[model samples]
Target: MSNVTSNSPSASNAVKPLDQGEEAVVRALHRVIHALPRAMDAELLREQGLPLVEYLTLMNLSETPGRRLRMNELAATCGMSLSGMTRVVQKLEAQGFVQRIRCEQDGRGWNAVLTDSGLARLEQAWPTNLAATRKYFLDHLAGLDLEKLAAAMRKIAT
Candidate 1:
């Protein structure tokens, strides 16, 4: 047995190179991580006239209470830096999909609120997103235990 556990910090820094089987797993994961997003983004842009990041930003706002969240919180939810998220939100605002408003609870902060137009666009775009998600991600996982897969991904992410 390898002196390594999948969950072990020591395994990550171990002196030995990964054996062939282990190397193959890592290689496959690397390929999927990079390929899936690009493929999905392309599909989204082709079918929905919406980039993935924009779609995700709208979706995140739509789900929040009052259809709003603090700007920094929205940035975190979208896995973006504040400045990067600011740029995306500004574009959305320009398109009339969202608006930035001073936070009512705290005048110092800002919130990004989904506009009615954004909700309508999200409604129109949902089917395309669902189909792409299934085609690019779910369909490939046939017969695998999804909950287990999610747990494994969570472990790796952390």
Candidate 2:
């Protein structure tokens, strides 16, 4: 599509610029990626007294077997660095919502266990999380094929 010879390696591997419609979609996607989390965080903090990261950490922990996961696994699940998850778990531990204990399977590593209080707190916040998710995200996806969209998104994420 250019003056450069198509046989060249650079030509074959070259990236193309977005057209107008493509550019609009990409920009909107970028905006939603950045804005959705902040909006949801604001709503949860106002209504549930929980920040999105903390809520996510708690929620993820609550879903795991025995309500526990290795610290690194929890970090990965919450899209955080290990150190970041350590801080969150520390805060939750201080509030009597989570407990950090040595991983029995491997003596060197640690696990983050959701305390009974943590489950109770998550239950209290579940409605707010659901409402915020629908308001800030799902409400706009009116008649779209959600299953297909989710599959596409999962593919893109990988």
Best by TM-score: 2
TM-score against native, each model? 0.86, 0.90
lDDT of 2 at 148: 100
**Clashes in model 2: which pairs?**
none
Instruction: Kindly list the per-residue Cα lDDT of model 1 for residues 22-83, writing each as its tens digit.
Output: 88888888899899888888988999889999999999999999999999999999899999
Misplaced by over 4 Å in model 2 are 1-16
lDDT of 2 at 101: 97
Q: How far is candidate 1 from the true structure (C-alpha RMSD, Å)?
A: 4.5
Candidate 2, residue 97: how far the Cα is off, in Å = 0.8
